[model samples]
Target chain A: MRRNKKERQKQLKETIMENPFITDEELAEKFSVSVQTIRLDRLELSIPELRERIKNVAQQNFADQLRSLPIEEVIGEIIDIELDQQAISILDIKREHVFSRTHIARGHHLFAQANSLAVAVINDELALTAKANIRFIRQVKLGERVVAKAKVINKEDAKGRTIVKVKSYVHKELVFIGEFSMFRSNFTETGDKQ
Target chain B: MRRNKKERQKQLKETIMENPFITDEELAEKFSVSVQTIRLDRLELSIPELRERIKNVAQQNFADQLRSLPIEEVIGEIIDIELDQQAISILDIKREHVFSRTHIARGHHLFAQANSLAVAVINDELALTAKANIRFIRQVKLGERVVAKAKVINKEDAKGRTIVKVKSYVHKELVFIGEFSMFRSNFTETGDKQ
Candidate 1:
C-alpha cells in the first residue's frame, strides 16, 4: 500500500504539471485516492496550493521567453507595486548603450519596460495580456532619462479581466503611451479565456 | 582630432540607438562624422546600415516587456519554418513544469511558444506583434502531449505588417486557436533583427 501510494503520487504530480488547473475531485477520481490525499500530495510536491500555481505558470512563461533573447541595453528597474491594479518603474535609457543595432531603441522597448514593471507589480501569479493599445507621441533621443508609469484602469475578479494604462516620458515629454488589458485566472476556474 | 573623433563616434552610437530610423547622412551630420564611419560602426555592432534600422525600431518593443520574467519551466521547442506564411513547433507541457498561484501553465506560455516560433521563422530580427487574438477551445490537461502550429495569413511590407494564425492540439483535437498580427523591420541594410 505504501509503494502504491508513492507511485500514485508521482502520477498525480505529472498530471498537475501537465495541466495545473485540474481540480481536487478530478485528481481523486482519476487516481483512486481521496481528495484529501491528493491535496497532501500537492503540498508535498511544493506546488503552490492553487492560486500560486496559476500565477506561477504565467510568470514562468515570461521568464522562459526572456531567457531566449540577447539583450545588452536596459537601464531600468521596477521600484513599486499595487497588487492587481497597477505598477510603476523607472528606466534610464542611456545614450551610449549600444543596443546591438544602429538606431535608437524603438518605442517598443520603452513600452515593454513599463509593461514588465506592471506585470511584476501585479500580485497575482496568473495574468495574461488581453489587449495593449499604445501611441508614440514624442521621440526619446539618446542620453535622455525616462520614467514609466502604469496604472490599472479596470479590474473585475468575477469576470477575470483587467486593464492598464502605461505612459513613458523623458523630462516631461511623452515618449510612449499604451493601454493593456490582461486576462487573470485562478487554477480552480477556466472560462472565456481569450 | 583623435580624441574628438572617438568622442564623436561614441555620441553617434548613442544617437543611433535612440533614433535607429535616421538616415546615415543625417546621423553623420548630427555627430560630425562621415556617413562611412557610421556605416562602419553599424557593421561593428552587427546591425544593418540605415533604412532597415528605421523599420526595425518601429516594431520591436512590447516583446522586450514579456521577456523580463525569470525562467522556471520550458515545455516547448520550435521545430521548423516556411517563409512569411507559417511556423511550426512542438511543446511538451508536463506536471512538473507548472509555476505560480495557478496550477495550470498560464495561457501566455502557449502563446509565447507560438509567438517565438513565428518570430524565428521571420527573415528579420525585429518582429512586433500588432494584434493577437486567441481562444481556449479545450482543456489541455496534464501529461497530455501537445503540438503548436502558426501560419502567416497576410504580409504587407509597405505598412510593416504580417498576420498569422496559430493553433495548438492534443491527440488531433484542437485545444487552442489564435490570430496574430506582427510587424517586421530589417533595421538597416545590414541584417534582420527582433
Candidate 2:
C-alpha cells in the first residue's frame, strides 16, 4: 500500500494545504512513512515547516486590501472571505490568551475573534458596530483552535445598516455566537459621515 | 513663569502618573522647559521613557493573580482594579490596530478592551460572559488613548449572575459602551462546575 515518491509528494502538498498547522509527525503517521521520509517529501515539494506555513498564510491573506479593517486587527487568520456574503477565520489560543491561574481562555478573546470576523466580512469603506448581542456557550482552553464563521444575514439599504451573524466553534462544538448590527458609510448616500 | 527644579520635578512625576504616555516634548511645553530638562527630571525621578513606562504598566498589572482573566488577553493596561467593584484600563491604538488603507482603529479592539474589563471586575475564580449588549458610539483612530471604566451595576446571588457596565472614552468623549452579564461559579455554591 505504499505510493510512489511522486504520488506521495502530491498528496503531502494537498494535506498541508488543507491544514497548515499539521505537524510533520502527524503527516508521517498518516502517510505510513518515517519522519525522515516525510521531511524529504516536504523538501522536494519546497514546503516550509509548520510555523513558516502559518506565518506565510497569515501574511499573504492579511497584507492586501481589506475593505473595512486591517488584517492584524481581525484577531484571527482569515482563511476565506466573500465580501458581505460569508467569511471564515481561525484563532489559535496561546498561553497569553488563557488565565494564568485557571488556564482557560479569556472570554473576550473569543468574542474579539468572532466580532472582528463579523466586521471584516462587510463590503464597505467604513464599517462600525452600532450594536451587538453576543453569547458565550462554552469555556475554551489554551492551545485550542477556534474557527469562527460569519454571514451577512440582513442588509438594510435605507438605514445603511448590515446585520452579521457569527458563530465560533472549537472542534465543531459551539463556543460563542454573536449578532452584530453594523453601520457602513458606503451604504449611505451621504458621503463619508460618521 | 518657570518654577524651580524641585517643584518642576515633583509636578513631572504626577503628570506621568496621570497619563503614562505623555511625551517629553509635551511635558516640556507644559512645564515651560526644554525637552532636555524634562528628560533630566525623568532621570532624577527614575522614571523610564514613555515606551518603557507603558511596558512596565502592562507587565506589572498582568503578572499578578487576576481575578477573572489573564493580563495578556485583556487588550489594554489594567491600571487599577478592585474586585467586584470597579476597574480602569488604558488602550493605546497603534499602527497594528488600524486598517492599512484607513487610520481608524478596528471596532473589535475597543470591544475587547471593554469586555475584558467587565470580566476582570468580578471577584470570582471562574467568571464567564453569559450575554453582552454593546454599542460603538464613535470611531477611534490610531495614536488615540482609550480609557475604559467598568463598574459593577448588579449582582444577583440567587441567579448567580453579575452585571457590569463599561464605558470607554477617548479624550473624555465616549467611544464605546457595553453591559456584560457574567456568570460566576463561586456565587452558585456548586464548587466549580464548567
How far does residue B174 in candidate 1 sit from its true spot (Å)?
Answer: 4.8
What residue runs in model 1 are displaced by over 4 Å at the alpha carbon?
A1-77, A90-148, A157-160, A167-179, A183-190, B1-76, B94-98, B106-108, B124-146, B170-178, B186-194
Among all windows of ten consecutive residues in candidate 2 chain A, which has the lowest summed lDDT? A185-194
Model 2 residue B63 CA deviation in Å:
8.4
Per-residue alpha-carbon lDDT of candidate 2 for residues A74-178, written as tens digits (9 for 90 to 100): 888888888889889999999877777777877778877887888788877677777898988778888999999999999774467789999999999988889
Q: What is the C-alpha lDDT of each candidate?
A: 0.59, 0.83
Instruction: Count the clashes in each prediction.
Output: 53, 0
The predictions' CA RMSDs to the true structure, in order, are 21.2, 8.6
Residue pairs in clash, model 2: none
Q: Which numbered prediction scores highest in TM-score against the true structure?
A: 2
Worst 10 residues of 2 chain B by lDDT: B185-194
Q: What is the TM-score of chain B alone in each candidate?
A: 0.52, 0.66
lDDT of 1 by residue, B1-194 (tens): 33376676677778777877778888767766678887887777676877666545432432332231111111265444455656566777775433333344434455556555555455565555544555556555556666888787776544455766778888898877766656566433222222
